[model samples]
Structures are given as C-alpha cells and as structure tokens.
Target: MRGAILPADSDQAVLAGRLDLGEGPTPVLIRGGMVEDVSAAAPTVSDLLERDDPAAVRGRPLFAAAELADRGPLLAPVDLQAIKACGVTFAVSAIERVIEEAARGDMDAAAAVRGRLEARVGAGIRSVVPGTPEAASLKAALVEDGMWSQYLEVAIGPDAEVFTKTAVLASVGWGAEIGVRSDSGWNNPEPEIVLVTNSKGRIAGAALGNDVNLRDFEGRSALLLGKAKDNNASCAIGPFIRLFDDGFTMDDVRAAELDLVIEGPEGYRLDGHSSMVQISRDPEELVRQARSEHHYPDGFALFLGTLFAPVQDRDEPGRGFTHKVGDVVTISTPKLGTLVNRVTTSDRAPAWTFGIGALMRNLAERGLLDIGGGAGDGHD
Candidate 1:
C-alpha cells in the first residue's frame, strides 16, 4: 500500500515541522510588553528554554500577527554562557583582513604578511586538512596550537565575567542600531549568521549577530586583539532564534539572502549584501574549533563570520571606511528578521590612566631600559 501525502494546504504543517513548532514552541517574541509565542503554543520563550525538549510545545496554536502589538523592544532570544566568533571564514573578509593587516604601520612587512595570509586562507578554502602546506603555514601564523590567530579574534572568550549587551537594539519593524567608538581607528559591523549551541556544543538554533570590532587595534598589533574586540558594549545579537529541525535544511539556509545596511550620522546610506555561498566553513567546523581546549558547560554563541563589505571608490581602498559614533547598522535576512544596533562611544576613563605613569617612572629609575620614554630616552 502507498502512503498518504500531506495536502497542499499543509504549508503551515510544513512550517511547524521545519521550525519544531508542533512539539515545543514557535519562535517567541516579547511583543507588546507581553511574552507571546509566535507558534500557536502557550509556553513562553522562557518556558521553552527550560524544557528538556523545547520543541515539544510546537503542538500549540500559532499566534496571530494582528493580535500582538505591531512592534516593541526585543530581547537576545536566548541566554548563552559565552558569545564566541570565528574569523577569516569568508573570501571577501579574508581579502579585506589581509589588506588591513598590510597597512599596519609598515608597508613592506605588511605586504609579506598579506601574501602569507592570502595563501593560507586560499588553501583553507580549498581544503580543511591539517598536514597540507597551506594548512601548516596558516597554523604556524597562530600560536596556542592554531586555536587563536591574527584573523580569528575571539570577541567573547569562555570567561563569563565578560558578557555584555545581551539585549538587542529595537527600532520598531525596520531594524536596530549598534554603538561604535568615535575614537576607534576602525569600526565596522560585520554581518554574521550565528549558530546557537547547547551546553555540549550541540546545534540548537540559529540567530543573526553583529560582530562589531575595532579594525585599527586589530591591525596595529596582533597582540592587542583584546583591546580591539573586548571593548565595553561592543557585541550584540537578536531578532529571534530559528530552531534546527529536519525541515530546516541546508538548502533552505543557503537560499536565504542577507544584507548589511548602514546609515551614518549625516544620513548617508551604504548597501552591503553577503552571499551564503561565500561562507567558508560550516557551523560544526566553527563549534569544533571554538571548543578546542575549553569546556562550555553553559553552551556558547558562535559567529560564523561575514561575507560582505562596503564598496570601494577611487579615493578609498577596499575597506577604508569605518563606522563612527551615531552610525546605525542592520543585518536583515528572511529567516532571522532584522537585527540592528547603533554605534556610541564609551565614557570610561582611558585604559592607561591607572597609576601606569608612576609605574613606568619607577621602572625607568631602576635602569630597566626606560621603556616609558622618560627624558626622551625611548630605550627598551
């Protein structure tokens, strides 16, 4: 006997199965100041997160868009122990990084490093094996057993003490704004499609992330990445989480489109779009690398990297443009909606002002190379 097929009117059923709605819950939103499950279920997003099987609540009814408030403030969708990010996983981003690294004070040294970076990233694009010449060369650039590198800067390390800005910036229905430091040498919102993993590194769902960074700090010296990435109020993610399920296929993900739109304080707009095909690595690969030596008992967030960049004109090089305070950046995609944030400068005191001058003077008095430039000695 042949099996019966779901009728054409079963598109809702298809969505339910695809998003794991029929069992646990549809994507939940804190709409109209009330917790509402986008799925037809009564379990709130918080309730679903606490369940052993969050998707079990999907059998509940779907929420009507009309009944909920048209718009309101949105949360980060889920609470994760750590927010991690991958780098050099896109062709355009790889090239942009090489170019920026090449411009780091010395043109000749930067040129040599740029060639090596290009060759490494190119080989990685072709294959992921460890023993290959490209793999070995790339591995050598990074220390700590290739877990960290010049390109792969960890925005949020496994340390829980560093979590910041878990809530997303809300702007009605269009998008959101992110804060950028005005004094930062280079700042840009990298549009990334992120993966949400469980405590054990299992894929749970996907969300959109804006991996905001200070490119100049990163370029100036590879050792200063912490200063470049771990600035206060520098990271954000939101819109909603799309739970992984049998129906949510890779084809569905690759077919979706993503755009990174920016608006400066003067209202000048720049359009940037990313191609999923340009994604160099998959979520599994990113997760494996992120969990290399550390244990994420509370799970973690992983940014899959960016594939789009601003267009370059004659006056500007490939990525000479940088985001300044008051600029707004939005990551828009059909699956994840629009995640937005505005750039703003931090008001904290300078990092070098905490008795550092006296310490430097003390070291100089001891004849320890006068590293602090006292009396214009400039000796090390």
Candidate 2:
C-alpha cells in the first residue's frame, strides 16, 4: 500500500489509469488521509454526459468524493445515463475481485479472489483470510444478485443516496420507490428494495430504510444481508460520504445537511430534509480495516452509500431521470423532456408483479426487519 505522500496542501484533480490500488477513489479519500485529488476537472466527465440539452435532467447522479468537493451542491436534477457518462477506469482488485469470484460459485477460486479483494479493500493484500465452501457458494449467488423489480417496496423518506447510483450498483434503473418499477405492471407489485428520496432532484445525504426483503415470499423466510446487500447498497450516497478519521464521530455527520423530497403532481408527495444527525462508520475505513480483520467471519460491516433518483412519470416528463434496466417495462417522464426510463427489451409479458407495503409487512412477519436502512440478522 505504498502511495505517494501528498501533503495536505497541493491541489490538482484528475482520474487515474489502470488499477491504482491503495490509490483509487477509496483510499485517496480515506477517512484518515487528506485527499490527493489527481482527477481532472468536471469538464472532461461533464462533456460526455450524453443528454446535455438544457431541458434534460435525466442523467447519472454520480461524483466521487473529490468530484463532490470540487463541484457545488448536488441540488440540480440529473438522470442516470447522464451520470454514468463520466467513464473512469477503476479496476476491481484483490478481495473485491475475490468476492466477485466467490459470488460466481467458484469456492476454491473464489477463496483465492477473496484473498485478493479483501486485501485491496482492507489494510493489506497479504492478510486476506481464506473463504469457506459455504461462503464461496453464497458469494456466487450474491454476484448474480439483481434487484427484483416486481417485488419491492418504498420506505418513502428524506434521504438515501444509493438509490441515485442504480446503474452502477444493482445494474438497474431506480427502484419501486415511487411504485412504477422498471418492469412492474398494475397486477404485479415490484418490491426490489426499500428506497428513499427527495422530491427535488438532489441527494446530499443518506436515505435510511430497513429491509422487508423476503427470501421466500409471503413471510416465509427473510433475505439476509448477503441477499439484500446488492438490493440495499448499489451505489455511493453522497456529496456527503464524509471522510472521518481520528477524533471524528457521528456528530460530524449530524452536522451535514442532507436535502430530500418527493414531488411529482400537485397533491401526492412526501419529503424530509435531515442533517445526517449522525454517521459513525466511515466506509473507507471499514473497507480498509476489513483487510486487517479479514480473518474474522462477518466481523466487519462495510457500507457504500449514494443518493437515489429514479425516473418517474410526472406532467409531461420530470427533469429528474434514471437509466432504465429491464426489457419489458417502459416509463415516460417529462422532467428529462422524454421517456426518461424504460425496459429495453420487446418483452411485454407480466413475468413478475409486486405490491406496496406488502413486501415490508411480509418481511416483518418472517423476521426480516429493516434495520435502519439495511437488512438485519438481529445482530448489531
């Protein structure tokens, strides 16, 4: 993990090439390390935001810590596509890659990959613990974990940033947050993940919602953290994933302003703008520290947050937008000035359907409670 020592003063910003381990976005902005933002200015990434029309608000709501710090408040409306336009190269190294291997069903190989990703995200590559066959199998299924469109519920709230990073995280566009999932039909309900957002097109805070996810629908069994991880944390929730280190505490997150709202037509809406009130685990630290604690199974809890903004149908098209996923469901919006979200395929069959609030109630019945904004096993 030998990196160039960047004093607290020198200033420059640009993306890195190849797999700059111990040097990519995660470490550069490590809760403890002063950022060495070598990334270029916004112009490069902004120019590629496909839909630049003054009217299109549909684009990706993405920006690393450096990008957020450099850019002004993320209060403007943006769609998913526009956000993903900024293509930067960050390799999936060591333990990160290892986990992907395990998630793919290769226990032995996955154990190897775990050794690597865990090392990279954690303190060092040399300390990764071996993965068990069971852990590896779980990883395999976990890798293919796609957000369910027909089975999701919305915990309408003021903040939850990850919703904004749909494309990057769950590989889907938005969620059943507002009811209309990317592949939902009137008959079937979509309760992929419980989400929260602001009515305006901004996410400067973390949106919290517990998991009502069911492993076997109808309150039979609850989806554990592994099953719900992809559903829950699929992106970076910020303009506010603060860098905390020695002496820093939840009090700082409490001080940060997180604007959230839910607006569409005139009458139906919900909004809550909260100052984070508290944030204790700095993700960067958790990830890195995991490297140190890899030996202990489930010993470390890693969280990756982001703002959520899905494509919704509102008078004409709402400026807010998202990158559609499914091949069957197509949504129209006036915010981005066009059909901002939709399924790309020609399939029209109602393969899956979901309901509102039912998913949450069912999960609770099965012992799956939304532990804050994440899933629960009743542990810490």
Best by lDDT: 1
How well is each residue in 143-163 modelled by candidate 1, as lDDT tens digits? 444434444332122211122
Each candidate's TM vs. the true structure? Answer: 0.63, 0.25
- Candidate number with greatest TM-score: 1
For each predicted model, how many residue pairs clash, with residues at least 3 apart or on different chains? 29, 78
Model 2 lDDT per residue over 1-380, tens place:
11121212213211111112222221112122222321221111111121122112222223333333233212111111112110000112222222432334222233454444444334421222223344334334434553211111110111112212222212222222211222211111111111111112121212122111111121122222223222322222211112222222334333434333333233433332322222222333223332332231112112222122122332234222221233122121111110111222213312222222443354355443435531112332
Off by over 4 Å in 2: 1-220, 224-234, 245-250, 254-259, 265-267, 273-301, 304-380
Segments of candidate 1 deviating more than 4 angstroms: 1-52, 58-71, 105-177, 254-256, 311-319, 348-380
Output the lDDT of residue 244, model 2: 22
TM-score of 2: 0.25
